[model samples]
Target: MDMMVSSLQQQRAITDQLRREAGIKRIPVSQAVEDIIKYITEHEQEDCLLVGFSSQKVNPFREKSSCAVL
Candidate 1:
C-alpha cells in the first residue's frame, strides 16, 4: 500500500512537471467556446463561401465588390 501511494504521487509529479514544461494549462470551458465562435465568425465568409459557392453566384458578387475593382 505504501509503495502504491508513493508511485501514484511520483506519477502525478511527473505529469505536473511535463505540463509546466509544455505550457499546458486549463482554460474555462466558456472561454474556449468564445474563442471558437470568434474564430469561426472571422473566417467563415472567407473560407466557407469562397470555396462552397458556385462561380455564378461568386463571380457576380465579386464583380460588385472590391475584388472586381482590383
Candidate 2:
C-alpha cells in the first residue's frame, strides 16, 4: 500500500512537471477536486473514471470494485 502511494505520487510529480514545462494553464487543486466531486455527485449512476495515475504493476480497479482511493 505504501509503495502504491509512492508510485502514484511520482506519477503526479512527473505529469505536473510536464504541464509546467509546456506552459499550460493550471487549475487550483481545490477547485479541481471540487469539480470532480460535483461531477460524481451529479452522475452517480453512470460509470466515471478519475484516474490520477495508471500503474502497469498495480492497478487498483477491478470489476464491481467499490474501492475509491481518494
Candidate 3:
C-alpha cells in the first residue's frame, strides 16, 4: 500500500523531471483539441499547412529558436 503510493509518486517525479528537461509543456487533451479546432475554423477558408516539430529546437514558433518567425 505505502510502497505502491511511493512508487507512483516517484514515477510522477521522474516524468515531471523529464518533461522539464525536454522543454515539454503539459496541456489537457480537451484543451489541445479545442485549440486545434479553433485554429482550423479560423483558417478554414485559407490554404493551411500544419507544420510539426519533433523537437523544440527546430520549432520556428518558439521564441528561443534562432530562426523563430516573428
**Which lDDT tens digits does candidate 1 get at residues 1-70?**
9999999999999999998988967799999999999999889877745566555675545555445543
Question: How do the candidates rank by TM-score, highest first?
Answer: 1, 3, 2
| Quality of model 3 by C-alpha lDDT | 0.80
lDDT of 1: 0.80
Query: What clash count goes with each model?
Result: 0, 0, 0
Candidate 2 RMSD computed on C-alpha atoms after optimal superposition onto the true structure: 17.6
Which residue pairs of candidate 2 clash? none
On residues 1-70, what C-alpha lDDT tens digit does candidate 2 reach at each position?
A: 9999999999999999998889977799999999999998887655436444354445455455577798
Candidate 3: count of backbone clashes, pairs at least 3 residues apart or interchain = 0
For 1-70, candidate 3 gives per-residue lDDT tens digits of 9999999999999999988888966799999999999998888666324545667776666776367667
Q: Quote the positional error of residue 39 for candidate 1 in Å.
A: 0.2
Regions more than 4 Å wrong, model 3 = 1-23, 48-70
Q: Each model's C-alpha lDDT?
A: 0.80, 0.78, 0.80
Displacement of residue 2 (Cα, Å) in model 1 is 24
